[model samples]
Target: MFEFLLNEEQRKLRDEVRELVAWVPRQLILDMDQDKVTFPKEFLAEAGRRNLMGCRYPRKWGGRGLDWVSTCMVMEEVGVLGYIFACVFGVGAELVCDAIIQHGNDEQKERYVKPLLAGEIFAAECLTEPRGGSDFFGTTSVAEDQGDHFLLNGQKRFIVGAEGADYFLVYARTDPDPKADPRQALTCFIVNRGPGVEVAYLYGLMGCRGGGAGRLVFKDVKVPKANVVGSVGGAYKVFNTMMIPERLGTAAMTIGAAQPAVDVATGYSTRRKAFGQPINQFQGVSFQVAQAVTLLDASRAMIYATARAVDAGEDQNHTRRLISQTKKFVTESCQQAAHHAMQVMGGIGYTNVFPVERIVRDLRLASIWTGTNEVMSMIVAHEWYRAYHQAKTSAPRDFEADALEAESGEKIYE
Candidate 1:
């Protein structure tokens, strides 16, 4: 029944994307990382030609105007190939394209969104600062009003695609009113990384090396007032709205990466001999594979359900909680799945010669980035509390009547 949700059209899209990624040549991914390559502009151009760059955006802006399911399918396929490609497209589609489609002005949309969709330019988000990543409300980035423009000054670390990004959706504090809520104090701006902005590469990360995550410094960068995204002091709303798709997209990627690891490990177990028999014949190995599949499938279902909710625009709070839970589950499952894949393959799995080793390293970062699993747990718990309280308050009340009947020694029946 769940499989039925994917129609013929969706299935075709998935298969086509899978084939495209399959021909990417594994050595290319390795070579990109080895050389510290800039964002693969040519590869992105090919993706644009395929219409994969704007899978969920409206067709008016050079997009295909497909549903969220199609977007998830495309992400899953890219993720299976490698996290580098997945991260690039994720930032492009979710953070960049979605923002422009939802909030950018007519001029802003034409200049940024159109080119982004056409793969002529790449975009990045500048939210996480050195001191205020998990606690975004405590950001120190300040923007001073200069009449017709604003002066942005601060540093952002761990900015993905910084080296090649044509523009950035940067968050800065515009209101310094001590009484103002932190959420209301900040503003979002579309800043071109030139003049006063400096991008420095962060070398030697654990994985996802192909996608450049760097430190971005802003020294009184002049941003036009017109560059503001949405309304001034409305960044918190934008951030909250964006999280749903971001987390759901991440979950899709986790499923994609994990599934391949499971398949690789299972195939190896069946073919490799141990004690004069197939390793897969051993109950221990088989059980591990079973556990991996079970977790992966469960995570996939959770992710899909969350994505469906987002598409329908129903129960946003519930969707956010589910997205957080799904991201944590899927990312942790993928990491474990990658570990199992390597364990089953023994020495061969650890060598650079094998893809699993690289995948395992890449998956390790998933648990760290995209609001670390620890943060996801906190978000889920907080939402659960809020939901519980809302339910308690809205629940039908017959407490007085029930108490009186019980006190009078009368039976209370449902």
Candidate 2:
């Protein structure tokens, strides 16, 4: 049996973030999107002053030195507000600042991580290409070394914050050894967006329209030799490390998005009268709300548990498996919850006037991006099978008294 819980600090952080973000009117998000806005530098600078931009990294690198769980809570609150503030600070700080802290040299860290933490600059993680998304190892982006610098030539698609990004953590193939492992062939470079680098906006997205995502075309864009992150051909490891946090953060985002829909539906059902009674008094609608709440709570538990494991420096393989399962479960559950929410809201949910419609569209992208739900399911199945096989020979043991008590209380079984 399992339980979903949040500590005092996490609760406080969530409250604070929610209070701060509440000041940002929803119409501002629509306005920003309509204006084709670049990053909101002023708002980000305010966030920087509050230390929100550096929530997960070490204090030495201008971060808050918090654990991954705290970071997840912060991300969830931001996601609840919408993608505008979250996208600006989340991608800039988590993906890029953390990458530099982990792999950048002293000079690189000082140049990129510090300023980014101060919200003086924006960064983008460029992994997806026009030719590949999940198949990042098959990237056709190439970077050629020329003594003092590397010339990058390729096109990246679906790059978040590309239009406003001052720096890009670009992944490219530096070695073309056909016999070498595909994953090992890929390398990463921190290239400034300058001459020969073109950024094109990806307008009219189905959802997450507040976030700036676009295509980047690099035509022999020159990068200094010192700008390489980690080892020359070590992108696989970097990618793996980066994804752990990314998936965990995504889970939090889904929970944030879904919870609102669930709340709205619950409120509507309890008040809207049908057949001379509140709609929620009906079994069908009540059951749907119950199921949605259960799934959301369960998903939050898995996500927090996985984040805690990573922060504790537990086994990487186990953590990755947990992360994959959490992402798959949460994203799928969110979509289902959104659908039920719409169903409960009836005709009102179908209109743009209600937020449930937008939430449904937003949650759809969660399943598709950051590795598809199909891919996550395959990974989860593989890991479960491996673990089962490895432990199958052991004898079974009796459950503890607490386990029995919890199980008998109708809690979900592990």
Candidate 3:
């Protein structure tokens, strides 16, 4: 909607989501923000009913069998509701559903993926832990191999849908040897809510509440061997594959969440007056609106290109770089755009009467989650260097030789 010219199918999907978002009760959003609700199950159930949950998967699996771009289009429209709605809305389809669709056995898919996309069940991905999510390989949560089953014993914190998820796609260290390679030492398991699984505590968050973010304690939870999504001690592949949609979907949804703030500020300025003229006449307000729109436009381009790249099956490394870059750039840009909206609205924007303040609080988490923007930068730089060196083997001009100092032999090195 920002700038991507959609085909008839894409436009139709967008309209459908717009109607769905319009249908969401405003009180539900407020209640969730105020910590009055644990999970927004109603929203997901409705989206699933419309067959809009995971548009990219096969229709046989309850998806539209659409491409990634179409899915992003859906996310962008859903995002306008707010961050909490956007985050929880995507957990099932983007993160949990994708993993099973890609790696789970046919039985697992039929049992989990079908019901999940059908909105018959809620799902959450347990990646972050008590120690921290950033140090993913530094997982303390262990699942001991117990012949017929694995005994999962540990805790996962900040898990959305912890209170209401029908099951969790948990990543736990499966290898007993401490010296095992971290990448190969882990595994993914679909742990259902039962027995020793407990939602120990629900955190009172600064924002983005009501999706049931909480601490999940698993005490000797017995999981059948068949529940393992991928190979034994092979969660790295699954995690990487899931992140493509994880980051891309978040980036797209955020566009809708952030755009409204800018639009609200723009509309307010047209009527808001300072010194007998509309606030839009002043550079202070108009410039902020101008800047926010520009940033939004820039973000749209990056998200659209990256989504297309993913759909077209471009190079893996290149696509990953684009994903990380889009995730980092779009989030940061949207955050700033919301800030501009707040600044433009001045005092009233700070209060809850206008949605700008809520937008600001909600948008703050976008840059932090889905892997921090800092992590995105690290991945981008790492990939760029690797790609640059790999492509350098082809015959090409050495621009360094053109520098006048090339023959001076004055270049010093450590």
Candidate 4:
């Protein structure tokens, strides 16, 4: 029934990732969660050694050269490990690599992508400033050109890999023209961490921790002109293009975090007794289980469909619309599924004894990060409205009404 979704090679790849995740001990996961420390670099190095770091990039750059669907599959498995693991891997593999592959020059690619995919170095995207939350263009970071180099000075907060990243794919206001288009005013650069760059402060998160969430302060950091990605005034394009992989990857990870929540809830419900019977025997609990399962399956389907559309090189705007919708729907659904799982498992679900509580905390960030669910809704609404208006002009009433009693125009108000 599902033959059309993933082929033999993809299935094998999924199994391979599952095996890789199996090597991650539950104790280590729990320890990391409790300590709120950095993800074990050794674990990431092992993933690189196994050639599982960049599944979508070309094999020449140390990746598997796989498709978006394959990358999503790997993301889903890593997601099951929890938010920290997903965030750590994602900083290098999805966020940074996509930008470098798209905008970096050949030398830039060799300097960053190869070592990143090989796990020799870590990377992070420095986008969110101290003031700007979801507003990418409102960034206050400035990169002043100094003949051969740019002196960067800014503070970026909520950077996932700030504490450990060897370098950052940083964005700054290069034009500094107040009247200029905000989209054209920004620029991207590859900034190495050195004397002028510092991990300023670490954030204590509610759920998603252990991925080195911190603030990065660039104090007159000198980045060479050769490090400019794409062009001085073309970062908007790079940022927008990177959104595709970012949103799709987040959606896939949502599925991963949600599936295990459903599994744990289901197992517990079937065994735990309530009112002289198993909790699963109760309609209230059973219905919640059914809903959780439905959400998981539906989320998986939407994410893969979006991934396939990306792989097929569908229309950029149309694919973006689908990507936004997938990220919004899947992340929200995963959050809801985790909530339902917690309810089904009763009080114990709220404790660390079960993974459901942690899933709840982890999935909350999925909607907030990558862009808020509200932002996703805005994109979906805008695209849908555009298509709605165009359909009226292009395909207006081409067919006879099937159920209407009168002409469509006649039925409408003046």
Q: Cα lDDT of all candidates, in order?
A: 0.81, 0.79, 0.91, 0.86
Q: lDDT value for candidate 2?
A: 0.79
> Tens-digit lDDT track for model 4 on 1-414?
133677898888777788889988777787777754565677677777777888889888888778988888888888898867877888788888889898888898899999888888888888888897789989889999899999999999999888888889999999977888998999999999897999889888888777778999999999999999999978899999989878888888888878889899999998999789998999999999999888888888898888889999998778989999999999999999999999998899999888889889888899998899899999999998887777776775655466666565667556
TM-score of each: 0.92, 0.90, 0.97, 0.95
Model 2, range 283-366, lDDT digits (tens) per residue? 999999998888887877887888888889987667778889998888888789888899999999988777888778777788
Comparing 1 with 4 on TM-score, the higher-scoring candidate is: 4
Root-mean-square deviation of candidate 4: 2.0
Clashing pairs in 2: none
Off by over 4 Å in 3: 2-4, 403-406
Stretches of candidate 4 off by over 4 Å are 1-4, 396-414
Name model 2 segments beyond 4 Å from true. 1-8, 32-42, 83-88, 395-414
For 1-414, candidate 3 gives per-residue lDDT tens digits of 753468888888888888899889989989988988889989889988888898989988888888988888888888999888879878888899999999998899899999888888999999999888788899899999999999999999999899889999999999989999999999999999999999999988878888899999999999999999989988999988988998999999889899999999999999988899999999988999999999998998888899999989999999999999999999999999999999999999999999899889889889988899999999999999999999887747877788877989887797
Model 2: lowest-lDDT 10 consecutive positions? 1-10
Off by over 4 Å in 1: 1-3, 393-414
User: Which 10-residue window of candidate 3 scores lowest in summed lDDT?
Assistant: 1-10
Error of 4 at 17 (Å): 0.7
